[model samples]
Target: MLLQGGAFSACNLAIIENRRLPGWICNAAPSGRLGRAHSSRVMSVATGEQMSKPHAPTHQPSLANRLRLGSLADDGLSYKEKFIVRCYEVGINKTATVETIANLLQEIGCNHAQSVGFSTDGFATTLSMRQLHLIWVTARMHIEIYKYPAWSDVIEIETWCQSEGRIGTRRDWILKNYANGEVIGRATSKWVMMNQDTRRLQKVTDDVRDEVLFYCPKELRLAFPEKNNASLKKIAKLDEAAAYSRAGLVPRRSDLDMNQHVNNVAYIGWVLESMPQEIIDSHELQTITLDYKRECQHDDIVDSLTSPESAMTESVSELQGSNGSPTSANSENDCLQFLHLLRLSSDGSEINRCRTEWRKKPAKR
Candidate 1:
């Protein structure tokens, strides 16, 4: 489904086509290939809200069309695919928030993996690797935004996976304006598989490695840093006078993903909630870096803490080894910056840390 831009007309086709999917294209949706046989049944959800409308028919595109839609750069070499999506009313910010973009990136990433037959269910069924109790988790995410699409804007996201390592897999994305083909932004994320039953980290097995490597082009020009050193080793320390804190924010069922853990995208909103209203009203997020240290479950009570750049006085060297450096220190910039922390309210266990930079709203054209 290719949605062009203007207004709701640009979104109509995309919405109609997406409704044909047997299940939601969200991280919380069931894994594996969705078939027409299951399209009519009501979805049984664990934590999130159910759709008010009926289930939509699923569309499985032909192989040729899939390649064309993704605008495959080189046949037989790249597995990059395109996902055409619409920005919905709920995802729109006063200026089409950065959190919304993060959500879209997450969706396309899952879809790309599913298209290549790398789903959680597939690991058990196709590969017969059920004994591992596998679940995929994002280790780190870094997004740089050049522009934020507003409600009704049609976006075409092209994504692909990089080769998998024994412990990590890399995925990259490019967001484009559907109407004129303008570049929107790009993001890259690192992921690792874990054992669901044992709650222990699992290495990428040989079978999994061989399958993902088949699609990964060793020479692909897209690049992400090897270590994420800056985003990972930076820590945010908040004092009473300089920080604003929101306590006892619990994760709802809706925040849980297919893995039954709080979705990483949900953290963006929780962290933003602690920022001063004035900054949210006057500025827009330009870039964000998040390092996931631990998972938050539905029963966990989370706390979000935020402090402006003015309040963050520590240097990067000071945070090298502290708390494993979940985040980075703030620096002066034309755009405003905020240091954020999301922790368990009970024992103050750090869930994840974030750093965000916001740009002033541009003057009306």
Candidate 2:
């Protein structure tokens, strides 16, 4: 379904066709027979979306030191990270896709810890030194998108540690265009640590505080309130009654991260894949809020479902497209509000749920 808005508002937006950014592949030999990068490649420092993995308690690390020990400072400190926008990072609209933006936000937050010697490996090593292991999990994420950059648009993203509560740590981000330095997006996220052995929630220990407090900024860049379960709408289970649904997407090897599970960003792409092609061609995403419930493994077959807020009106008269299909083409009344759910096909366990808002694409001049 297309975003059914009353009027197509104008915004300062630019477009570029998705194309790979200019860069040379490193000539260094692949790390081992398994083809892992043990030595640092001389390539540009893009966001760690492709590198960082969500560590799961069920598996052992196959790739060691992907999180560099050198990246962290002895005295924990956070710093701004720069990322050159890439072609694959953008969507059909030629702007940064929501998944790419979310990945950048996630990377900056994690890299802040990595830079402060709190990487996944670093944390495991630190806790193991004391006979404990904790896995960092993103509990809640809220993102606000003011603008999106096109392919090859260099952007700087800054993330910093906020305060830690009983079980959660807060992180925030500020994104700006590299050329003009215009603020494009800001986000806030909440993370909680889980004990690897017990499979239960763990409190932020003094060790965690000691490492992260040194980098916590006094003032936040964005004034986003801390999010809890009560603040957001709950997602309902979708059965055969759902309007739009897509299925039969199996997790690929490329989809699995170092954690041996599907990456969180992959869930966003799966939800979007269920979106109607007509809606995709005529609309642009505005904002999306995702609540991850469970981790999906490599052997799982996932399904995406969306329930549109507005039901399709039965008519074949005026809302017809060039092809004999009901469409909101060129109509000011085009907007979409979706409640999305992604789940396993076998037992129907929900993996993640999201709420998304879309606006009609402005007409080209």
Candidate 3:
């Protein structure tokens, strides 16, 4: 779903509050697909306090956008660098709603994977994977949850831009369980303007105007932005992440495939090295979504990130071990791993953008 441009603010430090519910931002009711079993449902969540009343369901809004990741980060939740994964009855739950968090992910992280619509809301609302330069700012926005319990209602959702760069912009957000703080989900995403015709990254000659769209729009000409070597690492802004534990591993020739780039799935094995051995052995992955931005090569000095936000961003997950450890909770180094926007000097060219995210389902010990 898309949102409109509202406000923005950058996050300085990660937040670590014992919040039961995430803060509320706006209200949106999604319209289901045609010929579906059920379309839309008016939801009353045991979540949090409801603020303003719905103006009127004049017309089902288009995919919503127009939000900066900074505003989401500026708030105390600070998911741009961290996120919460609550161990619930069925599965872990994050407090943030899908729309708000999705918007933020578009702004803050490197979303090279096109949003290809989720299975849960395939009908009326679903995020489809599209090229970065092809994305557009959502003109209107609203979210409706047809299924519950299985689908945590986005009790409250908000968006923000964590950072803005010479060529690309970063967004972040939070999804809270209105039913209190039973769950909260946060995310970060990034976008680069492109020449609509060529589907190539382009420089922004005009101000965001005349229908600044998200899923590929038309532009005059192709102009590349001045690339830089800056990394958009905002780890210090999250509260739910633990101190990172580094590990060293030797790459096997099998890890090196054609293209000489490290095979994508090989990174998960790298992350597993840093996680608790027990969880690695016991947990069965229930839902795994890997977003591969940059490829890895054999024998490179790679840092295997098993952190939650890293796992979520990269799609390589480790099980729940540290959350139970006070040491884990207490260790807040404010060190963010630089993932995206690695620039090379000389001509200021882009090497590549690399990041990962994952979620693990633990086998009952």
Candidate 4:
């Protein structure tokens, strides 16, 4: 279902007509030929969604690393290190389509990483989808939910990078029909380059930049902006008080990633961890937007603040109005809040600044 908000109050969101999604393709056979017979429909990236797999994990979080020495199960494939990551199973949602995010990843040429975080917005407009589809995210692109008209629940996603870069790259995904040959969705992504040592943003070099030009389309390979600011920035201080109204600690070496900066998505872990499990279970987000002002480095102390102003209505429960305490204020009204996340380096340097907004809806139960 489309976002139910009415006109003027609604966000203008467009998705490919459902008929445009891919049908299905059989598994690759032992001979290594793709699609012994091509389907009647040729789904294009601009028109449809496609569909795959992730890594073996350790209890320890991972850091970014250079090409490794044949550690990936040496089954002897030509492109071991460059294998496409598939969506074995993703909780991808339809309210926010997966195709939109794939396109975002396609914009960044490879040798890049997912740099910023993204979520649905509070104030919707032409700029809403444009910012998400055309820009880098500050956090991990999550699969909220995915389903098509014909299927029960076999959503497949295939993710791959065209090439690697010092920090940026071209990436794309195919959302496919698991049992048949169909392209249900598609995604294009872009990445940001960074200083591996300082974890600061870095300009891509001519050699590395030129290499990405091959896989990137003309529009996808636009001139890189120093930052993703909608307007020129006014300097905000790195002070402790202005920092936030809560805090979290990062005491792990693995908290660092290949770029030497904390991986962009790691902060989400911090945010969710700070909130109660009941809050997550009760709320369905209307929209969430993230802006990454700086990077959190190794051993940095990440501070967080959940403002009473941005609090979600569902997060609070009140006594039945009749027996209310005399000093009690109305809890149901004005329960929304703004969350401030302040991450700092071990040396007390402000590393990342973020603001998260939430709206609360009552639990159906």
Q: lDDT: which candidate is best? A: 1
Residue 333's lDDT within candidate 4 is: 48
Model 1's lDDT to the true fold?
0.56
Ranking by lDDT: 1, 2, 4, 3
Candidates, ranked, TM-score: 1, 2, 4, 3
Candidate 2 residue runs with Cα over 4 Å from true position: 1-78, 120-130, 219-240, 310-335, 363-365
Question: Once superposed on the true structure, which residue ranges of model 1 sit more than 4 Å away at CA?
Answer: 1-87, 90-95, 120-129, 223-242, 310-333
lDDT of 3 by residue, 130-215 (tens): 22223322111111111122333423444433223335444433444455533233333344443334534444332332112221
The TM-score values for the models, in the order shown, are 0.68, 0.66, 0.31, 0.40
Ten-residue region with minimum lDDT total, candidate 3: 7-16
lDDT of 4 at 2: 11
CA lDDT of each prediction against the hidden true structure: 0.56, 0.54, 0.28, 0.32
Which digits, one per residue and each the tens of the lDDT, describe model 4 over residues 219-318?
Answer: 4221112243211222233344432334556736765543355544455456445554444554433222234556665756766543333223332122
Residue lDDT tens for model 1, 24-88: 22111232233221222323332144555543423444344234444223322223444444444
* Model 4 regions lying over 4 Å from their true place: 1-154, 158-190, 197-200, 218-245, 276-278, 285-288, 308-338, 345-350, 354-365
As for lDDT, the candidate ahead, 2 or 3, is 2
- Tens digits of per-residue lDDT, candidate 2, 176-273, equal 77677666766666666666566466787876654344346545533243333212445455555677889988888877755455666777789898
Global Cα lDDT for candidate 3: 0.28
Worst 10 residues of 2 by lDDT: 1-10
